[model samples]
Target chain A: MAAKKLNIKDKYRLLTRDLDWDFSYEDPKKAFPYEEFEGIKITDWNKWEDPFRLTMDSYWKYQAEKEKKLYAILDAFSQNNGHLNVVDPRYVNAVKIFLTGVSPLEYQAYQGFAHVGRQFSGVGARVACQMQSLDELRHVQTQIHAMSHYNKFFDGFQEFSHMHDRVWYLSVPRSFFTDARSAGPFEFMIAIGFSFEYVLTNLLFVPFMSGAAHNGDMATVTFGFSAQSDEARHMTLGLEVIKFLLEQHEDNVPIVQKWIDKWFWRGTRLLTIVAMMMDYMLPNKVMSWKEAWEVYFEEAGGALFKDLARYGITMPKYADVIEKEKEHISHQAWWTFYTHGHAAGFHTWIPSDQELDWLSEKYPDTFDKYYRPMWELAKEQEAKGERFYTSGLPQLCQTCQIPMLFTEMDNPNQNSMRDTVFDGERYHFCSDGCCDIFKDEPEKYVQAWLPVHQIFQGNCGGPDVGDILSDYYRMNVGVDNMDIKDSPDEQRWNKWKGVA
Target chain B: MSKVYIALQDNDESRYIVEAIEESNPDATVIHMPAMIRIEQENRLVIERKVVEEKMGRDWDVQELHINLITLGGNVDEDDDQFVLEWKQ
Candidate 1:
């Protein structure tokens, strides 16, 4: 006999809502004592609602379908020798950045969401977090699988697990996720869900995916589009948590706003790599990094804060810094890579004449004024057989752990440097934003895994660049790094174009 | 102001919706965002389910838009077939 079918809302109410208990043995607060540490007061947990109303049955079904679709694309592409059909060899830099900097972060997210799922008091929050945990694990697996095809032929991708932990540029992402994973459940949600996923995910994904699509990387584009589809649900969870907190109690507003301020800046700083990837990395441009900020961050974020003003919340405090820095960030990041990319896995080159013209066209206000002359000089140096590559390790930011490469806001010649001394040990930051983060939590920032500092302290392999590059970084400079013209990738691609 | 606006939380579902809106309303300006997409068009913005289905490459119900719908400005004239946003005379 067939039993009566139930609608999705009823199923969610039964599976998620019906599972909550009014503990008979002890106080509910005592059972979920971890919730009280963050000082967020939730008057009633019933106020929370899953926007998608998904039950476990639907969740498994949906995920299995997506997984099937993903593997099919990967299998077919593998049979076709998809790596050879790429638009340019340089586009693989974007993929390298993703594998090295972004993939391990997904694994971190998996751990984070799993902990939050078990720790949070609310059934709804727990279920959403649990689902997201599974999603993140799927993301990491799928990403590794998608890029594994390239790994068979590529040089730099062979050592992502090692590089993410010990490399200089990669520490920016590693520490960012580590900080979130170690925080309390509520703070983790606000830090990752509300601030990172909800506030600034577009800037991270759009340029990379767009570059993949235009660069003839069908596998990467497929992976990115699939992951981006999941991000919408993650974003909803972010928005829902903030609203649930605000609606539960008025006191939760100020605490939530502080987290928003703190994480917004932190997330923005981590994106400096992406800014360079968008402007200097892509062979075919979708939009400049500056244009992406205006389209994605400013316009969309402005409307959101206006909506949230009803809860007496304000926009991020350091938004002006973001606006002012956008014009210079891509240029600064590219220059840093051009000089110091040998320490890392990816390569860098001076922009071609057409590429430099595109930069000026996209960044008319500042590129010509401040950044172009540096590239022009590099071009002349290349002509004279004097291409510059820095052998000195960069001074690391105590908070973000990136190099101290940002320039002074007004003075082009001076570096934008800030520092503070805690417990007789001096700490340096690249900008006031990073300094503020350090000042708030000296103990936390003090323990950062700064790569350059570790290198100096004889922690990462050894002091010698040769030992460090091969033994520690697992990279061969001439193979992993390139000058475009003399690269094996270029030579291999030339055969297909009949230019060989 | 002779403008109508529609806002949907930026997600996979709404990517198709935004693409559909752009196709139907050529004058509509989409504001890309971190968690949402907002579209503003002069006087009226039409959302055709046909365009959304084509963009998504699947069968899509017009009502599915509400799952990721955040907030919209202008009178929402919604039905099973389509959703139209415009100001009254």
Candidate 2:
């Protein structure tokens, strides 16, 4: 009789876990020093399950297939001038935000995972992190390649990596990853692997990808599908990591909870940009940010947290605040960007009359009440050859690094600002959530590379905002940064379509 | 009893899986959203490897289900031949 074939489980065990050796000469503690420092006790590495039973050979095979399929579509998109097919030139600004504001974070995730992949004593976790690190690297590469076609036809795409580092708003995402990468391995796992990949990724990807599809950007939509295929593995690993940490020892619960609270708040803040993109930037809207939040977070996350309740983890802190902010954040974020259009990497504009009506329909209680008036006034100003741009730099949250644009959930009229004196210096936060996070780690936050502060201190090359825009931020003055109404991007689109 | 669900991105790959799921779980209701397809069943839902393979007209790895999976609720019991989702009693 022929020998029975080895099943996937045994194959995975032999290929992955069996390869880990007993540390005889070098102390295992010396090998994985970061594990104990985070106060997460893993009593048994043996209990850690491989979330998906993908061995490296099969991982490469599947990923290769996805790459092949994705590249074919991307090549087709480029050859066919996919940039011209989008719903409007306004839609490309969303892609600009994504490439500049979001893509480098993928690179950061790669570095973060690659770092943690080495630090874990548990071979299962190390291998999981390694795979996710590769996925992040691939995601960044594919995202750039997918958007590269647009770079040829667009302006803001030129200085994405540079802008991510120096641009004021881009720091929100930049600092988020930096904070995660600098933490201990376990904290990194919870901050990114679990809280980000599992809890918040849908909010980021789904809206953007769906918006891409709705707006006829086939390259982005295809890449979104390809990246999302990898995301399943990342998401499962996130779930397994949290479960393993919680199940290992009772002491880990509170530490994990604290990380959850901090990262969840940070994740929400980081997603404010995505919320703005979903609501304001997409000419052909998929759904309002409020609706997406309701489905992805309130319904799906609610269920997941309910399941987590068994592990003594409840829904993250400030759930009520987050739920309420969904109705308000997109409007607030777009208004800030609209006012600061001259300083932004991408073009911004007042939403069309139809878009304003859509906002009113979507945000029944708040849109017509608070935000529409501002847009109307901006419209009137634009009509009279007096477009508005805020001359002074806004103060950024010390923790989240977002401009203090968000309002109190209860009182939408009032800016939700909080502050604390740390080491005899006052640091401001955008909300109670960010303020609490800052207070928890004042030493970490005090060292934040706030762009406005850097400009004031002359660390940024700026006697004038123009000098800063060109020399420091590398944004092309009058070309890359401004309203889409009469911008070159708009002119080019009209010329291509033979529209006056 | 509360419902259990699995959401998959609405695409070609998931169409076969959703069909397989519809055949396998008769009580389940499938709802299509903007870019996602959600299948909800009372208390339990299962995806059989054999059923998916038949619907796909090829060999199917149960792990491939993750390619388009958006989110899922309930306790999971997964292996090579079958993937089952249900709450603990």
Candidate 3:
């Protein structure tokens, strides 16, 4: 009789588990040094189940196929002048923000996963992280390639990597990743692999990808599809990691819970940018930020937490606050960028009358009452040739690094600011959640590279915002940082489309 | 009985999987939204590897369903043959 063929499970075990060597000369503890530092107990590495039965050979084969398909679409898009096919010139600002603000996070994810991939004792986890690290690298590359065509025409697409490191608002995302990467391997898994990839990834990818499709951005939409295929493996790894840790020992439950709370709050704060993009940036909107939050977070996350409850895990702390903030953050974040348009890397403008009405309809209880009046005042100022730009810099939350733009959830007019002293220095936060996160680790947050603080300390090039914008952040001043109404971007678009 | 659901991106790849699912679980309700397709069933939902392979006219690995999976609810029991989702009592 012929020998039985090896199944996928057997092949995966051989490729992953069988590759691990028994430590003889060196201690395993010294090898995987970061494993136990985060208070997570992993009693047995053998209990770690491989989430996806994929060998390195199959992974390369699949990714190569995806890259082939993605590059073909990107080529077609460039050859066909896909930039002109968008719904409106304003739509490109969303892509600008994405390329600058979000793509760099993919690179950070790659570095993070690669680092943790080396630190985990479980071969299954190491293989999983190694695969996700590659996935993130591919995502960033494809994202850059997809947007490179737009860079030929758009103003703000340049200097994204430089701006990611030095810009004021870009620090919000940068610090989030740096914080995760700085943690021990177990916390890194919970912070990124589980909390971010499993719980919050849909909120990030689905809206942006769907927004791309709705707005006729073929290159971006194609890349979104390509990256999403890899997201499944990442997400399954996230789920598996959490389950393995939770089931290993009862003590790990609280540690994992605290991480879920911390990362969940941080993830929501980072997604405020996404909320603004969905509500204001996309000319052909996919859905209101509030609606997307409901579908993605409230309903879907609710179901996930229900399953997690069996392991003594409840819904994340402050989920109610996040629910309320969904109704408010998008409006508030847009207003912040609008007032500070001169400092922002992307163009900002008062929403059209139709958009204001849409906001009122979607946010029936709050928009007309609180937000519409503010837009009306801005419109009045613009009509009077006194287009509003706040000269003074706003205070930023030490934890989230977002300018303290968010309002009190209960009172839309009241700022939800909190402050506490650590080591004889006063630290401020935007909300109770942020304040708590800071207090939990004051030493880590006190070292935050706050842009506003750096500028005030004579560290960011010069005194004037324009000097810093151009010299330090590499923004092109008037060309890159202003309203879309009369900027070079708009003018060029009009000239190309013959809108005389 | 509580409902279990799985959402997949609305694309050509998922259409075959969705067809196989609908045929297998006759009581499942399929809802199509913008850029996404959701299938929900009370108590349990199953996706058989053989059925999807038959529908696609090619060999299909159970793990390939995740290529388009957006999100899912309930406890999951997956293997080489089939993927099952249900609420644990």
Candidate 4:
């Protein structure tokens, strides 16, 4: 007779428990030095329960199957000229920005998880970190594989890793990841796993994937689907870590709270790119950033934070400030991108009348009042055959690294600017939220790799924007980035459709 | 009562979840849109772990529903084994 099944529940329990052994050879504290520095007190490993009873065997079995299905579809999509079915060249800009900025962060997360997976004292936490490490690596491969398929028919997909390292705008994502990675293991979990994955993941990820679907990008939709279950697990690990830390010691509440506040603000700032992608970059729309913010964050996140209030943790301090910025940040970010996008990878275009009307309808309070006129002016200049890009680099915030493009929350016309002197030098911030964060850890942030500052210091490919684009950014000028009228993707798109 | 509803992104991961939703809530009407899939039921929609597990041939947790979840309506009533959406919490 065949052996009885090692049923899922019992198997997970045994597998997780079997790893525990008496550490007579070395003191556990001496063995794991990184666990105690963050001041988190964990009394019992049993307090950490993995909501998903995943084990090694099942993990392997499930992941193997996903890769199989993913590659099969990727092959079919590539062979059939999937690029032709894509909605428009404008939509592919979303894909380009995603590939250039976000895909590398996946690789960064892979490294972060590897460190924590090794350093955590609790087996449950270690196992979760290990799985997350694997998940991040999986995301790295999957996103690049999907993006590489587009490279066959598109520009700007090359040199993504190099671009992420040196480009001016790429610093937003670079700093967001490295800040989390440089912290102690527990703080890293809070910074990324909880605040990033649990609180902010929906806002950044959902719209891009949905926008991909709307635009006939099947590979991107598949990338989103393939990672969904793993993302659910990552979020659970984050939530569970907070609960475990809180339950272990009363003092841990505030430390975790502070991390939540810092990371939430950081997460919001990092998502400025995603906000721009959703609202402006995608050719076919999903929903406005305002609506996505309302549905994904305001409603869902309200419930989540309320659930956590039982632990004596309230919401992040500047939560209301985020609500105010939502109506304005996407438009503000797009304008900056519109002017500087040529120096970067993708082309930026003036919104057609219909698109401008949609922006006005969606952003009724702010668009016409502030942004529509600017686009109208850009169009007017273009009508007379004048093209545009930022003549000089704008001032970047010390903490968030975003240029001082965001407007005052109450007064939409004025740039929401703040600055403070650390040591002897004055540092600029985009808003009160960023200024507050800078004051919290002035030293950690003063060391920030501000791209604009680096450029002026003559570290970036000399003084000329031409040298900066080609020598520094690898931009192919008119072919890689320009108006949608004569850009390479648009030309390819026209040629493909011209056949029909 | 208004229709009990949920929407998930359109992708391979959701196929099993959508199948499980259809299995548990027989009257569920699945609507396919660009990059998103929506489902509606008469007065209730149930997501059963047993059904999802059966579809994937592995264990599933109700929390896993969040991975594919775009938006869900009605009040959510959830437990370790199953999650149900109905008019009242």
lDDT per residue as tens, model 2, A166-230: 99899899999999999999999999988898868877876678788889899888888678778
Give stretches of model 3 more than 4 Å off.
A1-3, B1-5, B66-77, B85-89
lDDT for each residue of candidate 1 in A1-500, tens digit (9 for 90 to 100): 89878765677888777988778988877877778888999888888887567678877866676678678989988999998878778888788889999988889999999998988888999999999999899889999999999888767898899888877788899999999888888889988988888757767765567567777888887677667656766776887888789988998998998889889988888888889888988888878899888866786566567667778889998898788888898899889888875665876788888999999999988899999999989888888997877768888888888788887767756889998999998899998888988898898878898887788888877658878888887777677865655666567667767884
lDDT of 3 by residue, A137-223 (tens): 999999999999999998999899999999999999999999999999889889998888876777777766788888889888778
> For every model shown, what is its TM-score relative to the native structure?
0.88, 0.97, 0.96, 0.91
Please tell me which predicted candidate would have the highest TM-score against the true structure. 2
Q: Which 10 consecutive residues of model 2 chain B have the lowest summed lDDT?
A: B66-75
- Report the error of model 4 at residue B28, Å: 9.8
Runs in model 4 lying further than 4 Å from the true structure: A1-3, B1-33, B38-46, B49-89
Report residue A286 deviation for candidate 4 (angstroms). Answer: 1.8
The list of candidate 2 runs beyond 4 A from truth reads A1-3, B1-11, B33-36, B66-76, B86-89
Name the lDDT of candidate 2: 0.88
Consecutive 10-residue window with the lowest summed lDDT within model 3 chain A? A49-58
Per-residue C-alpha lDDT of model 4 across residues B1-89, encoded as one tens digit per residue: 44556778676868999998888887889988666787887667888889899999888866556556665544455566787765421
Q: Please write out the lDDT profile of model 4 over residues A1-500, one tens digit for every residue.
A: 99887655567677677776768888998888998888888788876777666787667777777778778888988999887788777888888888889889989989999999989877878888998999899988998998898898888888888899888899999988998998899999999888888757767666667777788888888887667547756776787788789889998999999999899998999998888888887777878999888866776566567667778988887999999889988888888888876776887888888888999999999899999999988988888888667688889999889888988787889998899999999999987878888898898898999998898888887778778888888878777777677777887788878932
Candidate 3 per-residue C-alpha lDDT over B1-86 given as tens digits, one digit per residue, 9 for 90 to 100: 56777878788989999999998999999988667777998869999999999999999988677557766655566778888887
Worst 10 residues of 1 chain A by lDDT: A481-490
RMSD of each: 4.7, 1.6, 1.8, 3.8
Taken over the whole model, the C-alpha lDDT of each candidate is 0.80, 0.88, 0.88, 0.81
When summed lDDT is taken over every stretch of 10 residues in candidate 1 chain B, the lowest stretch is B70-79
Q: Comparing candidate 1 with candidate 3, which one achieves the higher TM-score?
A: 3
Which residue pairs clash in candidate 4? none
Q: How many clashing pairs in candidate 1? A: 2
Shift in Å, residue A184, candidate 4? 1.1
